[model samples]
Target: MLIKWISAAALAGALLASPATAVDLTVWAQTDLSPSASLGPVAEAFTDLYARFQRENPDITLKYEILPGGTEALPNLLTAASVGNLPDVAILDSFWVARLAETGHLQPLNDLWPAAERADVLPAAIDTMTFDGKIYAAMFSNAWRGVFYRTDQAKSLGIDAPPASWDEFLAFADKAKAAGMKPIMIPGADTEVTTLHLISTFWGFGGDLVDATGKPIFFEGANRTALEKTYALYRDLVQRGLLGTEVSTMDEKALRPFFYTGEAAAIANTSSGLQQMYSDAPTLKGNIGVFALPLPDGGRAAPILGGQTWGIFADDDAHKQAAWKLVSFMLQPANLTAIDAAKGYLPVNQAVWAQPFYAGDPLMQQFKGIFDGAKIVKTRPPVPIYPTISSALSQQVAGILNGTLTPTVAVDQARDIVMAEYTRQSAR
Candidate 1:
């Protein structure tokens, strides 16, 4: 017995003396900032950021796989997950967090992440990556949608400030129209943009898309009222000719020439796009201004939050920790600030906001204020069914806008479709 114990102890000591094996981590990242949306130098900027990470961590070998945006990345990841071929770390769209979370493929970060790290994240922004009481991912980049208007146009039309409420928005629209300017441009041509805009309007009208358990509840009394109010707003925009004929065909990018050149008085888009616009047309910088999207009476304003997040996939403790280290490195204030500045995304960490770069910039200051006031919303619910639901809403709303369906019929049909999906999901 004594001889056997001695031999075991010797083997344990030898094992402990062996050098730790190096870890090789593969990271999947999107080249474009958003799905179908590209800001200046996003891919190059991320490459530089990854090079920096490599410099700092000499031991870990990094392999990067750049994925295409818009309907490509998620499907790729899903396929990989099915075969257990997922990368160690991946940057996921904020909306995909919930869907992936439900798959059980993602590692819950609540155990891996520290509470102190969450201290300064805007609560609603944090909600984007959270599901089932655990944070499944960390926000890497951030964006919010707000009303962008030509300040000079508004002032020349005798408007002292941007609209504060839906009534005020309509009144301002009327004035802008009288002044020979298109009031606002809604990007209904792009399904995601259309979804985000309508979601904002619905939320502002005190509507919610899903209940806490991720069930569709938009047809409930108050929620249905909010939906109708949003529908009415869109109908009014069409009737008043505020949206105009081109809205049916033009995506957000197509509206840029109009908005930047002062053909449109106001437009709503992700806050990051503001920086891109300013960069592309320097002359329009001082002429532009932004504000949170206005709400209807008895409602609250919350610009829908959009951005990318990094999550871990490997299950082994060592690999998970190694992946987390890379994620944590990317989240460092300076590194994250540079990435956000390059991509035109707002920083998710509040500490990054304190940096002089954001504080000194007037546009970023406005974003800071928006975050401070909690005027943010995560438009998509954290459910597997959201992508389908969003696509359906986009199509149904387009129908409503084109006069093919009334709001009541559209809402009822949408509800039935979602409930059917919910039942399908339950059966699975």
Candidate 2:
């Protein structure tokens, strides 16, 4: 009896001293935002980072799913939530933060984040993640759009300076055409691309796309004139053969080869594609330059704020803490730089800004300037209904480019759709 009791006590002690079971965390990341080969740079970087996190936290496991679809990712998340299958963590566009927050699908990070930790991130990033009076997510990978051009082509055309106005841009186009090169690559097939052009042009013409109250005011008075002028620019580009007819069927990806081969003079795209450009043609490394989109009159309109935000969905306390630990691990100095470098995105960690890659690189020199001056377009306002507004507006813009509807008619229809959405949300 004594031997049996001793043996039982020893077994219980060994069990108590053994490691606890790991907490499993599920995360959904947008593959579109971070384009890499299926199991490419981003996947490898994240896998290694997760391993490091696991080493430190032996009791936590991470399972990350790469969700595709650029702008449509929000809908997938919402659908998942509807079925009570929301992941522990979600990576959503910063512009869609309000939509998810207002729907009560996000877990507020304020309570979990210490003030000192919050201060370590960029203020602008935090502002995007904040809804009402509370912070619901942590934003990273800040991005901005720019007028990327082939340096050698521009120099050969005697373009010693970036275009300062609309006339100058058109003049450059004419020169490029005379030089036997396509003036620009326009992603007319992409709704997001069309809307971005509209927003930049509209704002440059001193027109507002949305009012302070987050209502669509795109067709009101001078705003309508602004919209017409933007459309006219597109029509003029198409007429001059500077913007090829093939644009209606081609996306931004289709233009990369054109740019690399010197067939296309310039393209207005975000820095997200810059890394791919370098990889596609190493010879063009020193031949590319980035500039902000200039207004017709003179000055530059702000670039749209582009990036992703990480959120912890409402879940049990253990899950929330485990998810946050993963977030914190990914945000670490080495890990953040590795992932952002692999993905071609600007870092949200303020400390990383001082790193040589961003501070001293010649390629980054141009985009850094644009990022400093970029603004969030009205279509992506910090309101719950912005997703609906952006969707309606983009569809109409695509319609104009596809020739199914005139710009004037498209703008009118879009205005009505947005107004209707606003009214519906108000009543709700």
Candidate 3:
């Protein structure tokens, strides 16, 4: 099993609300996986909000359905839309925004949100959900990948703080290596994790996956340099035995034992993983800390902002209006603040950060700093061929890390495959 850590309340609520005669509004979500487990605070809060919405609008009912995962959810959504059987609203991964809208299955929200309400959201978030000059969805929650280190381990290593730059990180890794601790654990089986780390570093070096025109640009000069540096780091770490060969066979879950047991000093993970760690290993709480991933030379740090959005499906007018209303209500600062605080996620709405929950926690405050300075945050290009592109990139990255393919050759092949897919999708 992939072990999707979802919300317990969402699952309970899903089962508890099966009443008769309710004007059901279908919602497609990935937040209601485990019946006894909670996805996070956001899902719990949404579960409550849905209940409240049903209460207020007695005539309009809502039925929430859970999608399997990002990969399955996207294709299912497209298939449903093509058959004119789309749900009322769907929670979509931010990366699918452009591609979904291009298919004409999503409703434009330009007139739905007022100028003032629109301005309340983080600018980068708003920009990410917008496609071809039209806003198609509302940015809701965000997760950023960064360096998660054990504070006690740093102290034991005679390091007072997390590394502020790539060079410093390398030095820290060397120290951890000397102490017989794995500097970091990279999960090769779960390509998303490794890919995110690699991509963040690429962005730190000023490489971009897409050009200004939203075209694939994987073979550019900046990207080549990024790959070379990444491959060098991999080879050096593996050759020195600082990162074990088992890493190549380890899935996402495989690294958790190492991290929880203190065999690994640090890991690059998203905020969601942070939440899960706190739940699964309460002993590690307070000792864990997050820092922005370092940049090359003396450049500023850049974290990849991963998040989700709420999209209204092209459906009946009544359902569309209800969905929009639900999205607007959820975006309210109070709601966003509570949900983010509970779920350990950064609120996409800027005003939500000013709330007491965010203001009072030092850890959260530090998190906010990373979120504020995240300049390279972007959703993957919204293309129907994204899965293929992702898989190709993952294979190439795995090959580079395992020395099965030269970095140059691997990247070049990835670029060719992605470009071809882009052209094929465009011509359709």
What are the models' TM-scores? 0.87, 0.86, 0.87
User: In every candidate, how many clashes are there?
Assistant: 0, 0, 9
Clashing pairs in 1: none
Error of 3 at 193 (Å): 3.2
lDDT of 1 at 64: 77
lDDT by residue (1-428, candidate 2, tens digit) is: 99999999999997566357668888888764333344367767877777888789878777778776676777888788788888998787787778788768689998887788778786777876776779988877866665789878899999977887778888888999998988887666646665665577677677776777877777899988887777666766776677776766566687788888888889867677777777778887778887766766676756666577778994789999998888877777677888777777887676676677777777776666666555533225676665565566666645565467777887788778888878888898
Candidates in order have lDDT scores of 0.77, 0.74, 0.73
TM-score of 2: 0.86
- Residue 163, candidate 3: alpha-carbon lDDT: 86
How many clashing pairs does model 1 include? Answer: 0
Q: By descending TM-score, how would the candidates be arranged? A: 1, 3, 2
Q: How well does candidate 1 match the true structure in TM-score terms?
A: 0.87
